[model samples]
Target: PSLSLSHSLSLFLFLSLSRSVLSPPASLIVSPDRSQFFEYESVSLSCEVQGNSARWRLKRSTVFGERSDCGRNWGKPQGSSCIVSLIPSHSGVYCCESGSGEHSNAVNITVHGDRVEEEGG
Candidate 1:
């Protein structure tokens, strides 16, 4: 018995799909990478995927227990990246999520309320 051309092609496609399914999800890259940030600052969040990043979107769960996507009411989406103006309310966990339900590593961000001034005694 011999395999048909269509059968071989189907097998190849299956293997390719299997490899992608087993591969790790995309990663969320943060600019000026740090856990802490001051209020009124800006941060950049982008998705680094195996292929095109346009399939992924930046998401966040704020400290106020609100979940939302970028470019909605939070950050502005520019290409595959999101530019966010930092605020105390923006302190939360951020990550990248694909349309296929794949999620990247989440990052915790903290935005300080205000800078305290020190007085000389």
Candidate 2:
């Protein structure tokens, strides 16, 4: 008894699909790379997705609400990276997400200061 050619091809495709599905998505890397910061410090983050084509943006979460995109006012968007000035309000968990919803691991950031967090909206 032997396997048919179609069956072998189908098995190969299944293995490939399983590997892709099991692998993690893109990764988020921080520049000045520590998770701790003083107020007004500049923080930079970039996404590390293999073969990614500028389809991702930094997504953030804080105490006041659900997650949201790091907008232009928060920082400058250059290529696949974002540079944000750390105000206390900017203290939160940050991650990368493609517009299509693929996500990377989250990074927790803390801004040390006495000032109250202001509106990020």
Candidate 3:
């Protein structure tokens, strides 16, 4: 019977591509989990998404290295979180992408400088 209808259409296209490659993408969370920062303290970068309505972007890299785009769109409410505020060059890696694009897994920040040293022996 046409080889069992070509093996049931190749097992329904391998179970619809294994359920769309295991289906899991769209969730971002960033907290002060040792992603160090200092200097005029005021740092908050949060992003979370599960399904629909997500837009958050903040990029920074200085201290002799250049990268721009401090903010963009940034709209996420209803349980999710999106907050941004950090100065002192806003050093190093920070990433968050959504709106169906799905990208969030790079949070390395280090903004130092709160020096205080004056003692003579």
Using lDDT as the measure, the top candidate is 1
Who is ahead in lDDT, 2 or 3?
2
Query: What is the full ranking by lDDT, best candidate first?
Result: 1, 2, 3
Per-residue lDDT of model 3, residues 26-112, tens digit only = 434555555766665555565553445336544445556765544442222224444444555666776665545556566777766
**Per-model TM against the reference:** 0.75, 0.76, 0.28
Pairs of colliding residues, candidate 1: none
Q: What is the C-alpha lDDT of each candidate?
A: 0.86, 0.81, 0.56
Residues 1-121, model 2: lDDT tens digits = 2578889999999998897688646888999989988888898888888776478778898877767776744767877788898887888899988888878889999998744454332
Q: What's the candidate order when arranged by decreasing TM-score?
A: 2, 1, 3
Off by over 4 Å in 3: 1-24, 27-38, 52-79, 82-103, 115-121
On TM-score, the candidate that comes out on top is 2
For model 1, the stretches where C-alpha displacement exceeds 4 angstroms are 1-23, 117-121
lDDT accuracy of residue 19 in candidate 3? 62
Report the C-alpha lDDT of model 1 over 1-121, residue by residue, as the tens digit: 2569889999999999898778756888899888888888899998889887777878999867899999878899887789999988899999988898889889999988765531222
Candidate scoring better on lDDT of 1 and 3? 1
Give the range of the ten consecutive residues with the poorest summed lDDT in model 3: 70-79
Task: RMSD for all candidates, in order, please.
Answer: 4.0, 5.7, 11.8
